[model samples]
Target: MGTATLLLPPRARFGGQRLSQSTARWLGRAHQDNVEGDPVARAFDILPRGWPVAAVTRQRDAGDAAGSAWLRADPVHIRPDINGARLLAHGDALGLTVSDADALLPSLKPLFGDAGFPIDAPVPTRWYLRLPEGAELPVLAGPARALGADLFDYLPDGSQGRRWRALLSEAQVVLHNHPHNAARVAAGRTPVNSLWFWGAGRLPDHVRSNFNEMLGGDDAMQAFAEAAGATAAALPERWRTGEGHRLFDLRHVRDLALLDRDWLSPLLADLRSHELDAGTLEFGDGRRFRLERGQRWRLWRRPIQSFVEQSPAGDAPE
Candidate 1:
């Protein structure tokens, strides 16, 4: 009677790679589909229709910003090798503890404070900075984009870009030689050598979503649901039966094989039993497929080969 949506990253199929058998079969059965240009952008589009809410800001404000713009100050590792420098995603910045953050805060907070941005470390990996009212902030890419890619292009840009750039440069130098990082290196762990700033915005008073419940690990999803006056929770071990539209955020799952066993198989069974009216699967690489119970009878459609098998050389699946 209602639609169930699944949002996942594009790791389902890379160039010349294929998904697990169950997932591939389900993709072939979908009745409607579209490709998005950016997986992250498309994933956000499925949320209860609202202005872009700053995730780090929402996490910091905890539903009370009192009117202030916020930016993420996520910890990161700059990997250097023959390929030069690479900024690891926040998740990949391994072994960084709260104590490490506390040790480095004194040395780093003053830099941001001097630049007029006050910093706060609610969590070790996810930090926040409060921007002055009416400050013009530059558009910066999320850590997802910076992971394993050149960081130069993803830096903040726009009116105040130069100021932010200078601050970031200074931060790198300070973090590079921090005693905490040196100790981390001594312990054979990746040192936290840089900070990432993005997702800048103020929390909106009102947000709306089609779903009655939002289930995921993402704080933004929880914050959005709270703002929209809906129920939000961490995903359960098993999906519970519900009546209204529901959104399941599975973007954190990067392994297609694991997703097939854990999610797609169960969902396929639900569809065949007519337990769900319709279901939509979104991939991180910008492709989406939708299937309804009635569409299952279209037996003429055959399961496709692995996405990698169908993809052209050096191109993503279409």
Candidate 2:
């Protein structure tokens, strides 16, 4: 991987998270670049929030969301909270099947349809609302942003979302009473009791990325790569040589252990032998650790954890 810069996203649990041996070693020896932006968005030059991801991912998953405004109406599982309902899980965790979607969506379509919001579920887990060009939208963030968080906090706010809020309430009522939800409850499975509306926008006229190719990303990242004219493919089992700049989006690697086994281990070996030159390991928490072939000799540093490795109780970890 000559001169190819490899980048990874921030770890979700970095505050008290332990790094894998290989990950700890490589990061410990690297120098912090002190970069200050969401690394993934920075890579694609998209905003950290409010990026038109629904339209982008729709282009990949469904192929028909372009040339119009679109918003994700993803199926979600929410639980009641004292404050309000809290978003529990969505997408893959819900195990949404086409049959499940078929069982749930029919009664809800006319609600949006009558209100001039055309909706469809091109894929089982991903649904889209094709809003008219003249329609207005509030900030419709992705469901991931609200995972395990209070749903009302992330819901569209104020007058802009009044119509959406009303429709969403109606949809929730419909899903809550559906026979499918009862069957799911009987089967010990969580019901897809709500819909998440987010990523609202039309596909942009242009988008670009510095990387020549992208590795290991979801539909949205693939769409970003495609829109920017960059080649994309599944992440390989191990690091390999490549022709141009390559990006490995690690957000999907929920477990840091897999990151060490599949990536950081191989990276350290290659970087030491000059098989891989230099690159940056960027985290979303505003730190990009930089290292090169020659710099790999620093074995004096201890295993690093998190961005700064501070303890939760204001003491360093043993």
Candidate 3:
């Protein structure tokens, strides 16, 4: 029998901090296999470039593919406090669209373009600061690294850091003073006040992975699979344990009941009946556990009802 590996977001549904009832029960019966991973690294078994490559793949999907060095300048909401500002919401929380982007970008583009970096948003939620070939810039962390956390700790440092920092500051000022922010505040929406810049590099010649078949991920993950000669696509309506090693991204499942119906219930049944050999569940906190068919017989261990909630740093958007 083949193995199924699943990746779960710690905060799935409107800030949900718990897994499904079926998932919790299975975890209690499963063996504590191993917990190892850098939270920023992709689950794919390749030398992942992290966000830069993901952005390139997305840009390609949007019909604006390019080979230039790329940097993600995605929009983010920064809430200032006594210590420093924290990333309030990003990615899907912004609810950006082509029209919204058209409104906010015209003012910000010339600022970066004048400084030799041109900006583009092929998809409303994803913005790019295209860097020229051989351009020298400091390494920066992606918005994912700074989400819901203090922005100061994730800012770039070193000689070129100041230049990038200055550009970021300038971008914020332009956004803050923009005429649309007033409209946004009046409408009770988060203002488009900041841009997080990271992911800088030329696209690699090839993307590699260990799995031959995969399911459930964004365009970036699918692009990587195609480049690596693997089959990737949407998750099916229900679990059908297939041949070869497989990867499943369960983060997109925002509805708890839907997750249970689509995957959790049947999965537990398969493990109990020994239809599958083994399965693994991994969380954003680098915690991984394995469930085997034989483990269902363990009567002494109590089934877990509630899982340990992840900290702010570990909790991710669903």
Candidate 4:
């Protein structure tokens, strides 16, 4: 609706992954030039890994003698917030009142600064709710979780994509009807986006492996696909939007679907169970809040992204 504002450079690194350096520089220039829209910036940190290469030169020099140099990176889902209410709720979950969350603006640097690689800086701990349409927004901080989603055919076509839209609507319904998630949202618990992670170019093998582990066998895989197709066919036309496609974490695969309704009830019941208690503490004149938990949260521990898409055997599915 408005003139498009670039968020990040087209090539900026997502998560800790190495984005093309040229992209990062372009983003920096955009920021310097006072670009508008969603301010996209890079967050970097040194994650502990199985191997630490002291020098890439020697490794490259070895050539055939060099062992496989592998790098693993976890990706995150990025979204924009168009409304203040969702942003307020996100702040509340992190133990900040909306005003308190808003007040943290001036000290964003020193307070949120980090000391890790790529120049280190504090990663603002907050969840995002992106509207399909872009809009100017206020910063809202909160304890956050993310949902990993893929837009299969999400493009700039005037027509809306049908199947992808139906799947997203279904996912919202499923999440809303579930007592645990609904209650969490009602109580201001920021649900993080379940994002995807990649080691190389293809989908990770662990996806299929995880499904087999959860479903108890591979017999259900094909059946599951058929079931999805049938559900898609039966979906009401009113709910359909044809044009773009999305295949995020919950799009094609979801762990929740693999489990029965009865199986999910107890988990929700436990979160509501009184034995669980959560508390928060604020630091730096209410700039940062730390949530301390005393009870077990089942949904928190489950890896839902793996269930949705089988790791791309050769790059993620389109």
Best by TM-score: 2
The stretch of ten residues in a row with the least summed lDDT in candidate 1 is 309-318
Per-candidate alpha-carbon RMSD to the true structure:
4.4, 4.5, 5.8, 27.0
**Model 2 spans with C-alpha error above 4 angstroms:** 2-26, 45-50, 237-241, 252-258, 297-318
**TM-scores of all candidate predictions against the true structure:** 0.83, 0.84, 0.78, 0.18
Q: Better model by lDDT, 2 or 4?
A: 2
The parts of candidate 3 lying over 4 Å away from their true place are 10-26, 38-42, 47-51, 62-66, 212-219, 229-244, 252-262, 298-305, 309-318
Expressed as tens digits, the lDDT of each residue in 251-274 for candidate 2 is 555556666677777777777776
* Model 3 C-alpha lDDT per residue in residues 1-318, reported as the tens digit of each score: 667777766533325445566566566666653355543245454443444553456556564555667777888889989998899988778777787788999999889999888988887887887777688844676665467788767767776777887888899999999888778888888888888876666556556666777787455566667767889888777788677777887755566566666776777777777676788777665666677876666655555544454222221222
lDDT of 1 by residue, 1-318 (tens): 566778777644444455666656666766544575543233333333333446424553454465778888778887766765688657434766779779888888899998889887776766778888888755677786567876666775664777877887898899898988898889888888778878777665445667777888766567667666668888865545566788888876666566666777777778778787778877676566777776666565666555433422221232
Please give the distance, in angstroms, between residue 314's alpha carbon in candidate 3 and its true position after superposition.
22
Q: How many backbone clashes does candidate 2 have?
A: 0
Off by over 4 Å in 1: 11-26, 35-56, 59-64, 81-84, 91-95, 236-243, 309-318
Residue 119 C-alpha lDDT in model 3: 89
Error of 2 at 47 (Å): 11
The sequence of per-residue lDDT tens digits that candidate 4 reaches over residues 135-160 is 22122211122222222222112233
- Compared with the true structure, model 3 gives a TM-score of 0.78
Per-model C-alpha lDDT, please? Answer: 0.68, 0.74, 0.69, 0.22
Could you tally the backbone clashes for each prediction? 7, 0, 0, 38
Off by over 4 Å in 4: 1-160, 185-318
